[model samples]
Target: MPADQLTDLLDPARWDPLPHPPAMEYPLPVRRRDPRTLPPAPATGSAPEVLSRGADGVLLRLRHRAPRARAVALHASGWWRPQPADALDLVPAGDGWWEIVLEAPADWRTSYGFVEHDGPGDPPWWEAGLKAPGAPVHPDALCAHRHGAARGGAERSVLSLPFDGLFRAGRDDAETPAEVHELPLGPDAPRVRWWVPEEAGPAPLPLLVVTDGAEHVEQLGTPERLRRGVEAGVLPPLVAVFVDAGEHRGDVLGVPGGQARWIPEDLVPRLRAAGLTAPGGRRLALTDDPARTIITGASYGGLTALFTAARAPGTIGIAIAQSVSLWRYPRGALVGPLREAAGYAPLRLRLHAGRFEGSMAADARALADALDGSGAEVTLDLHSGGHDWAWWQPALLHDLAAELGR
Candidate 1:
């Protein structure tokens, strides 16, 4: 696509309502439930149902039943401050069913919801409370699977395809789970959740520091995934620290701030004081070497991961930034400084982004290109899907294994 065309694609204003594609384009399999029998046979069946699978991709049918609704729209993650015009409006099926068929990759997963407009005129765009005069977004009542709760305490519906991966599934019955502990740094600082291997040998282990700790723990099940990787020999036994930012996430992780420095300056020193850095102190020990220390996060946290590593390469050597918000800064603003810093200490970076994330995806590619051969070992992995945790959780596991398994 041309640059102009790509810009238009990214612009939500250009996204008009769409109708379901022709049957020939997305041929429904005979074994699958037909669109006419929708709301599923049992009536309580979960959605968005998989209509068909083909060489191209899978066809997903997302539906909502609102008998008196004037309009309905679909809202997915990564769309910030979404307006009704920015969303995909669903067409009326029959009775009161409104639905849209989407084509997605086999491994795609995302959190989505439906907006029902009942009032006169245009529906209001979503606000913090979703209390705008016109419409409010609601999770798919028919879909049992749900993602994390948003600002208004409303959970979004999850649409996930079959994925054959170590991290997506829960731990096996026989595998020993990683021991989780809480570390309080001070009243002013956020608490940290630590995960130590159950059978950590008496040797210094690699460390992974994750930002946006609470969400990764509660929503993504990251610690368990890490535990699974270690037991399966896909990753080395290690210590992982999840740093909770709480309400101060934007102040700390969004930019270069004092609280952001706590990870390298205060947190590491405190962990050492607890005898986590050397062997023979307890069940598990962590490496003091920055080369074995990896820091990772997504979105704004992702931007912070790169910033933290660049600022303190001696404390953090590897950075795995997933779906980074490089656009938060001016275009290429971070590239020059990052390149200069890497030229001095040389950092290893793994940049991951989704091809569906518009300019964010382009920015990741641009950052990778700008950092090339600048004394930094940089690798960029572009995956299918959007900025939802559905992709970030599994991608983080793969990154950890790739970086630490060797």
Candidate 2:
């Protein structure tokens, strides 16, 4: 193609200004339509070998077939929204490949794509091969790894808690279940919130006490999916308690993650109080059925789930960690700790991450591998997306169905 025509192809208005590719390209159809509290993210890395990131840019080594394009210049649009700017680094070497890095400001989010160029602009301008199907066509939602397909065919939801402050725990009374009554904690109480499933038919519904309760509703689509899946038969009815993590999510969800107070005293007693009173009662208390119990969350919520599972063996049988914020904490590498934890106690886990969202996929894969090798039932889902609700929701729904539903 002539340079002029190629330039025409490279025109900003030439392509659809949507966040992602079209419907045919939409990998997770259900996710594309919902309104989430958390918006899309900016660019991370591209290429391989370097390392993708949850941070602004992702780094990778590219081995594209073209040798001349090795000296490729990079240009992007839709990242953070409304304009075009520099977003990638392409440095080629003798190995017939180049090292490419893609970046955007942390809060700058929206749809974006890259074009390959020669000098400042190339002769045969071509796509950088980084968009996905079913991605929004508007710049409002452009982001890398929007649907990295970290986990596919599963459904997910994101609920936003419009408030932030000291979290309060509340429960319902039998006479008047309408009111959400506040509960009490000891001297130094850990914030807690109680969950009453829409329909509770079985005894000892498995329990999952998630840290950063408010954030789960804010960042991840947990409540909606949990309710819908139970109603739709996709997942079994399980009791979930989102413990109020408040501002200390960093400290609480990390080393101790607030398990001492949250689990041993607060959680168990509450479930016992809510006791199995229906018909011929079974001894299956909410906190009793370990195998049926699963602790889940994303990011810090994710790390907390893993930490809780690691510390409390036979108590929390399942761990659902999505885009785990492992590097944030001391000894943040969760795999080694999990490996040791698994030795003392057995656990089943569903770990997943994508290439574009930091080193999530790689790190989680290593952890899953280690646990699986140690005789734990582990499923490793490496998707084509990043660290966003777009991928997390579907990944958890599908992977959990395989690991826990059956």
Candidate 3:
């Protein structure tokens, strides 16, 4: 079945509704537009319009004006993977317009794009891999809200709905912002971007070690959010360390190999030795207690966070893993180690997975079930979106507020 059709199998009634924004209509009426006339393509940088809303979800019409293309397909994160058969076909409407209407939860958010195929039977460029040469995905010209550059600097378009309070902690206007510092550890090590909260005191603060540092900082604006979160008193004052994975991300991130050794063994010691100091010349220190140390990441980075916690419980005690690629390893392979670690010492974990993530969502549930009775304080948050940074950013802020709230 096509990716859009597969979504029809999901009953939104099964999932609880996300908190609604103030004075919003329960079921929004269809916009006033002529049925015969196609809605004009949104201006560049503007989001695609929500056509209508119903009890099931919202109706979003994705349009591509590709007159010469043989076929056009919608490629949204979590909706369509590498499989060509799963591609959401956009039917020819009128003129040069090719469009498809998607029914999604009101709180749904994701990055998407359209692909123009040479032939009807052509496979998606992503089948070869995002980094493959000539596999660039075309961003939606209409929708301007982009998230994360991939496939040789090609950014994906964003579609965000109202999800109240999920990102409320990060205020745009803040009196005091956290100070950011770049630390080049060595030629062999990943560069670290450190965020030291202005509220830093004499006492050692909790540390948050984030994997895929560049994406978290550049794409997600996590440091700014963390600063806002601290200033608002929604989160406790702490130090954030963003670890740049570079090209070797695939080699060292998720796999229980180099990252397992480097984080606790090399990175932590080096940071301690450097003695991070705030802009005010107040010497900032990191807590030695594992319970005060938190590690987080998304996708493969998420898997790495859990793996690192299990391997070095004495170094990391809390893990906030989002959209973890638990399917990477053989079934029960990663879970076994975490279960063993929990038996020795209790670990606090926040596991997030999207309902649209298919097998990854199942794997997250399985991991949560396996951790039961293992003495780990685990909370599983099944969100309404996909495996995109659109959800990951707000979800990260939500986790920080819940876990380390003042």
Candidate 4:
């Protein structure tokens, strides 16, 4: 049952909780663009304003005008689907302008757009208001930056709320260079990127395995952060291995044994042969003391990190999960077994979740409590943020310091 639980968790189809946005749902009802009914982009659009901040969330006011719209609504990535309750009715603010005010978490940063509808049955008119030329598509781009296809094959806008959390800035001046390695898991396997802190001296370095390797390296600045951490002595020198999920990320990182097999059977051997050390200059081994190995990730990646620690106890001594999807199906499959694994290997964990992530946040805390007497050391923290990179980027930095500083 325990082994099956791990395999069940690895089932990719079961992992993703949020469906792709409506815009991404292709073959959308086609309607001829009626110039009279088409919304003429918003004018004088800067960014939404933070009208007020309170205990619940932040109140935001966004102004635009769709002369033809009988109804308007706000849509964002986090919501499962754009609900009628999320609809924003345009109120005449004068001079052909209308405004809609919505409340969002203080740390919410995501792609969004204002959709206009002509009638009850009319198809939605997607409009990303006038963005400054080369301004990176504003007021609606889905994120500050996007990778792969924009959701829905339709361009939305970007909305980033103000956050004052402390995230150490990465250093670009470090002489250490990052390297990319290929893991031949077939032609479709995720690409690999790594950085070995030779600067940590002759001793073999510890290893930090990051899921979602490509984005963390390119978008989230993982390599730069590692470089900065080593040079600043904030974290001990370590070999950082980033795993890319490619198209099958859901199958690879989201599922339970997906990462377990790849890391131990595939990644570890490759790193060992490449002269990457697991403490004491020894080749990487699951049977090693385990304390020297760390696996970390956010969201589904976070979920996988915990499973990896349990599935390959001798290989991973520590797991750092950020905003993990504990609220998903087979919800407590991993947690339940971890609590009952009588001879489970000694492991340490650092968990970080967002106060705004609702149930997932609560689940993370509960997960930590569940592990209290299970022979694993655990720490859970709730930061004022959301499920996006804006929160995880800095949180990862802090998690590293906590683990490698030991």
Best by TM-score, which number?
Answer: 1
Tens digits of per-residue lDDT for model 2, 1-406: 2323322322323222223212121121110111122232223433222333455443222323235543432222111111122223345534444334333333222212233444554323223223321122211111212212122312222111111111101111111221111335664766655444556665567666566565444334355556556667766666666676565555555444355225633565566566533334433356466666677777766766776665564566788777776555432355554565566556787776654565567678666665667656677666544455544555565555555565
Clash count per candidate: 0, 31, 1, 11
Candidate 1: what lDDT? 0.69
Error of 4 at 143 (Å): 8.5
- lDDT per residue for candidate 4 within 1-406, as digits (tens), equals 3544544444455444444223222111111122223344345445566667787577677666567666555544444222243244445556655666656766666545555555665333332211111122223321233322232234444455644223432212333445444444466446776665545565657778888876766544567667667777787777788888676666676555577567865677666556544345644322234688888888779978876776666667788888887655454666654553324567788888875454667788778877777777888877654455645666677777876677
Lowest lDDT block of 10, candidate 4: 24-33
| Each model's lDDT | 0.69, 0.46, 0.68, 0.59
Q: What is the TM-score of each candidate against the true structure?
A: 0.76, 0.52, 0.75, 0.63
How many Å off is the CA of 45 in candidate 2?
Answer: 32
RMSD of 1: 10.1
Candidate 3: worst-modelled 10 consecutive residues by lDDT = 23-32
Model 4: per-residue Cα lDDT at residue 363: 83
TM-score of 1: 0.76
Model 4 scores a C-alpha lDDT of 0.59
Give the Cα-based TM-score of candidate 4 against the true structure: 0.63
lDDT of 1 by residue, 233-268 (tens): 898888889988787666677465434467876887
Q: In candidate 4, how many Å is residue 117 off?
A: 4.2
Better of 3 and 4 by lDDT: 3
Candidate 2 residue runs with Cα over 4 Å from true position = 1-187, 218-221, 257-261, 264-287, 329-336
The local lDDT score (0 to 100) that residue 116 gets in candidate 3 is 71
